[model samples]
Target chain A: DVKVTQSSRYLVKRTGEKVFLECVQDMDHENMFWYRQDPGLGLRLIYFSYDVKMKEKGDIPEGYSVSREKKERFSLILESASTNQTSMYLCASRTGGIVNTEAFFGQGTRLTVV
Target chain B: AQSVTQLDSQVPVFEEAPVELRCNYSSSVSVYLFWYVQYPNQGLQLLLKYLSGSTLVKGINGFEAEFNKSQTSFHLRKPSVHISDTAEYFCAVTPSGNTPLVFGKGTRLSVIA
Candidate 1:
């Protein structure tokens, strides 16, 4: 089965702390995405990487950065954690070079910034 | 740019009853549409997708969606829903490119026993 794995399921961080959320995909997909899901906001894209070392800012990219050093791993970093950043972070991967494809998502990491 | 709008925030239905989740999208060019389901404490799963060809697309768990070009809607429907079908459904759209997907807020389906 295709799989996308997240490093942590739950995390708690103090304010102003640097936070990192790791995601790895076994499907070897070229496109990787990070989204923060809120109660009513659904999933707001934070950042996405279509190729190694290539990234694009999404609608809500402030206060967040992403790294795609390798093909299988993608990371989301919070420069300074804040209470407002407490939300469920989801990582997704999809095949590139085509428009007709669906995304495969990791279980998700619920991050709480205190 | 593409955007999706889910009409209902929540829908309550008795078990074995039909349900429909409305989704509308706006885009200048042709787009790819998808419906995803997210269970409690889980990530989203693709329930169905509409890339092209036939407007009527059938998906897993007896769920189907019809793409209406004139109306700019892709509404999901199930003949009879079970308790297991209770989950949050999301509608997403991406234009004909390698861009990211834009999602709707979501519709939470509550199946009453």
Candidate 2:
């Protein structure tokens, strides 16, 4: 079974503070993604990394960035945390298969910005 | 570009009842469709996927979905649902290759005793 683990299951930060969410996958998948889930908004991609040190902006990338220093780890960074940034963040990884690869996700980190 | 639309926001059914969650997508190119379920406080899990070969795909938890290219719809259904099936179901689509999936707003399934 594939395992995707997030660094924190819950986090709290003050406004204007910086925050980091870490994720690691044991499957050594080539593609990793970061997404913020909101009620009625579903899962919107924030950033994704196809290879080490390479990243691409998803639909909503403002105020957020990502790092993929290694194949097994992906990190999401918030430049300046705001109250509106409080939401559940998810990390997922997928292999490089021709067909649609099934993405495995971590439990998710629920960040609260006060 | 691709987008998914889940027409139903919520569906309530009693145990052992049948249910259907509707999903539609808009894409100019051929795409892969998927149904994912998220339990409370948990991450999304793949319930089923429609890539090729068969139009009807069966997944875990006795869930299945039919991909209708003509209708541009991929709807999930279950004949007899259990209370454990209560979760948020999301429909997603991606173009061939390494493109990221576009997800719908999701449909929350609530199964009562």
The i-RMS of every model, in angstroms, reads 1.3, 1.4
In the range B8-43, model 2's lDDT, one tens digit per residue, is 999999999999999999999999999999999999
Compute each candidate's TM-score over C-alphas: 0.98, 0.98
Chain B TM-score for the candidates in order:
0.98, 0.98
> lDDT (0-100) at residue A92 of candidate 2?
93
Q: Name the 10 consecutive residues with the lowest summed lDDT in model 2 chain B.
A: B94-103
Q: Which lDDT values do the candidates have, in the order given?
A: 0.95, 0.94
Error of model 2, residue B107, in angstroms: 0.2
Error of 2 at A21 (Å): 0.3
- Structure candidate 1, residue pairs in collision: none
Q: Which digits, one per residue and each the tens of the lDDT, describe model 1 over residues A1-114?
A: 999999999999999999999999999899999999999999999999999999999999999999999999999999999999999999999988864698899999999999
Residue range with the least summed lDDT across 10 consecutive positions in model 2 chain A: A94-103
What docking grade applies to model 1?
A: medium
